[model samples]
Target chain A: MKGRKINPKRFEIGQLKIILLILPLVIFMGMPIIFIINHAFKPMEELFAFPPTFFVKNATLENFSKLIKFSDSSGIPLSRYLFNSLVVTVITVGLALLLTTMSAFALAKIKFKGRNALTHINQIAIMFVSTAVLIPRYLVICKLGLIDNLLAHILPLVAMPVALFLVKQFVEQVPDSLLEAAYMDGATDLDIYLKVIMPMIRPAVATAAILVFQQVWTNMETSSYFFSDDSMKTLTFYMNTLVNVNNTVAGQGMAAAASLIMFLPNLILFIILQNKVMNTMANSGIK
Target chain B: MAETTKMSRKDKKALKERMKHLKSGKLERRYARMGYIFMIPWFIGAAVFLAYPLGSSFWYALNNIRITPLGRIFSFVGQGNFTQILIQDPDFMIYLVDYLTSTIISTPIIVVFALIIAMMLNMKIKGKGFFRLIFFLPVIIVSGPILGMLTAEGAGSISAIDTQSLTSAISSVLPDIIAKPISDVFNNMITTLWYSGVQILIFLSGLQKIDKSMYEAAKIDGGSAWECFWKITLPNLKSMILLNTIYTIVFISNNSENPIIVLIEESMFSGTKEKGYGYASAMAWLYSVVVLILVGLFALLLATRKDQYEKQVKRAIKARKKEARNKKKIERRNRRNAKKIERQRAAGKITTHTTDRSDY
Candidate 1:
């Protein structure tokens, strides 16, 4: 795949032009994450420096050890928060991808009563900001007595409209003949959906999965709003609390470490799936 | 005997023909039922989590809402809350203007920036995937608090060169009005780049879908690269551009750190339950109106008539499918109705004259 030559006629831009144009942007974008990662290893005094030290003089595990020491006096241990984030992110993202992909199939492939109407309704939901609905959503959660419950946070995002929309756009590219062939062989909608369509739209799934996983992962505000229980707190919530607590020299170092810990999984995931994600996104078959 | 004799000959023939298992509409309905079943989970979730909450926001906005000791209470207050937020609240108005301005300002910059990067990536560049990865990496790391912090000083200038001095130097050379936004985009370039992650992906995908022959055809016809882009690439990307615009608007405006959102939250949680929730909901509604209008304007600018040919093709395809479905539906309905009459006749419920609709 790597050695295959690219067609110059594709975008008709000079190689140097692309390089010159993208260099500034890539440098601008990549620098901060590098700093954040480097800052995590700094000793306490360096963390406190203004016009902050771009690189730590000496890297140490003191921040993480300090984080552990501080958590000893807290209501829930830090590891529990990490576990909470992991459990919720995995389940919610999985459920969201399944539900959205299935829905995208039905809406994109199957013609039924009210199909257009339903798609439009969901599109309108896209424009209508979710923040407006927060109070009511909170009330809806409370009415079901799910307050202080992790389920409360997870349930709301399990049917993601944005992800569904993306998958639908991708699934529409799936040849109708494929579904018809499945139908000819006696595959039901559910069967076609699970076996045939889902496999075809893998890139959309990856894209949607990445999106939802990030949403669930970096989520700090919503969890605090819904769940007051300490044990149910997410890693983001704990990190926020860690960052805001007293702003001590040791605390800043620990906060940096926490940022790294929180940032690592996503970074690792990005490295793994980004190419597939880009390919899927680019998979729109215009030809 | 007379009741049986009074039955039309047409009905007798139809009923005689109905005794087979080929009443296909039932089977089709069964298929539809399966489709509905497939949709049920999303429908229920959307109703409960999305629609119900969306509807309730308007209700809460209109009413005087509060949490009572026993339960939540709502009294109709008409436009009282709306008026208060738009007309009375100073801070809400200020934040509203700021958020609205930011969204209006940022939407195009992000979309165009993403489009350029996407087209750039589409070129025959070495390390295409590498560049794509670099563009997309920020998406994963940019959300939640880290992004919020990075933008705040958010990812404050990590460069040793004084960002303040840099901006002032640039500002001194250029007019302040021109300098402010240019500096701002530079200051938030990382954030801007991060925001474009998905947009770039979307545009790249849209670019990929462009048929190779369109380019070949243009090339054969003596179309230059710039002409080909305007005629082929830009037109093809119109719908995707429209989508990216709305997405950027919603993403940027509704970000947790947006002062407007912060104001909405502070009012909802920190203000008294009686006054706070209602006013907060009203502000949120105002926020919704602004977002929708901005989105509407973008859609109009990018989407108008660009997809008209595509839309007609799609509509033609849909219309054909609908006609086929309707024909099958009527056939099934007629067959099923004929079967029902046969069953009723067998059960002795049809003791009077009957006629086929076709005969009538």
Candidate 2:
């Protein structure tokens, strides 16, 4: 083992091995997407066919077209729903990132007596299910007069301790010497943080941002409690209506179409930022 | 040492003073102060947002408090909600069984799958980055809203359309061999996309940190490729496996993922004036206990296996040492025999040292 170097001879074999390695990942990754797309496109007859259709075509955009035009008689507007989702998601992501970064910076660089206790408490909070906290959160929301408001969804989500945990882990990797150097150069504590710390921990922040956004956007539990109006519902609530409320052939088709559409933005986001997001997650101790 | 001993007391005292001054530097004190200032946000957030809510929820779970649509609170019944869930609810058992079964099956599969996929992603290959992107995409998009929209009826119907029928008719015009599995495969694919993201990330990171030397050493010792993976790779992944298991159990067991539980609660509480929140909380607590048990069991397995692994490494080291000793003795014997042959040649006598070094 000590005498080994890069083997040019085994390169071909390694490449082949890599192909073999990737095939299942492709299946695992590709299959679900392909299924969802197919489900979205297929007629009911094909969806429940004894032998399923992977490539049944005459694929039309009618389902998607009809889905986009869908508006209930209750005036439960999809656009309003999308807007609410965006608002709540933005608040959740923005607050979560801000709070997490500050706390993480403190935990990593600041020498404090209770630092370890706080860090460990944050870790335990990671395992504390939002479900476990749901009832109390509901009570709190009502008490705060936030019930039925979008803030009800955003505020509790920003409390997510995992974001703090991730940010702190990332900030820990930024050498203390860097902060000292900044201070030596006559930078204030706030300036050092804004200029040096923020730049260094950018990757962690991006990873945390994506994670926070996804969690808030896709969240149903918190939203379900806070928002009752169908018009006030997020896209997920709208999708749920197709499956549980409508439950017809046309409804299922629309549901499938909406599911695909729901995936489109995040899918696009993932595709665009995946390299950075994954690499940052890897660096930020997500693994 | 003499130089240090000969150092002037004045010089030593000055150095000590400098060290003490360094310890209480203004910069250090300010940094410490800044740290507290920075931590205030998270500290405040956690106390108000997390701890307070958690403690309050526990209290709410113990009491029967109802909130009207208009945000009005009804009278509280002490311990009634907990008792109802513990003793009176039928859906409690059903949810428990559903949750437990799903958990038992999904946890292992997700962890193992994540491990395998991570290993694959870690390998050197063409389009490795591309594949990673694909694997992670499912996780990104399969949000509840997105999935809900995809499954929505009028919003995004999944029913068979006239065009689908036409395509099927056209596809039936083709051979059965290609069409059958493709269709079935496509229909079920999207449903499984939601859970693969975390698994892939876990596995990829686990694969990244495995030492390359392990494979090199195994190969040099005439070990097969498969042997290298089993001996070196699997044991190293134990902690990762534990993490993914716990994550999977928690994610799957959560009522949010399985909406059917809520529907059942609705059914059980349909005719009654009760909200069944107490019953649901009780069930949640029980399920959380099961999760804790699962986590504990996995930890135990990891601990025992780690011990076994350490022992095995020790034995391997010992065997290698013994083999090295034997090889050294054989080499020494060969050297002595060669010396004797050289002397015999000098004396013009026949030599018996005919062994080939190549054969040895």
Error of 2 at A41 (Å): 2.2
lDDT for model 1 comes to 0.77
Clashes of 2: 37
Backbone clashes for every candidate come to 9, 37
Could you give candidate 2's per-residue lDDT for residues B143-203 as a string of tens digits?
4544553444222212343445644874687676445434433343334434657656654
Top lDDT model: 1
Model 2 stretches with alpha carbons more than 4 Å out: A1-13, A43-52, A72-77, A167-206, A228-232, A278-287, B1-32, B66-109, B140-194, B202-245, B258-275, B293-360
**Candidate 1 positional error at A83, Å:** 2.3
TM-score of chain A of each: 0.85, 0.85
Interface RMSD, all models, one decimal each? 4.1, 5.8
CAPRI band for model 1: acceptable
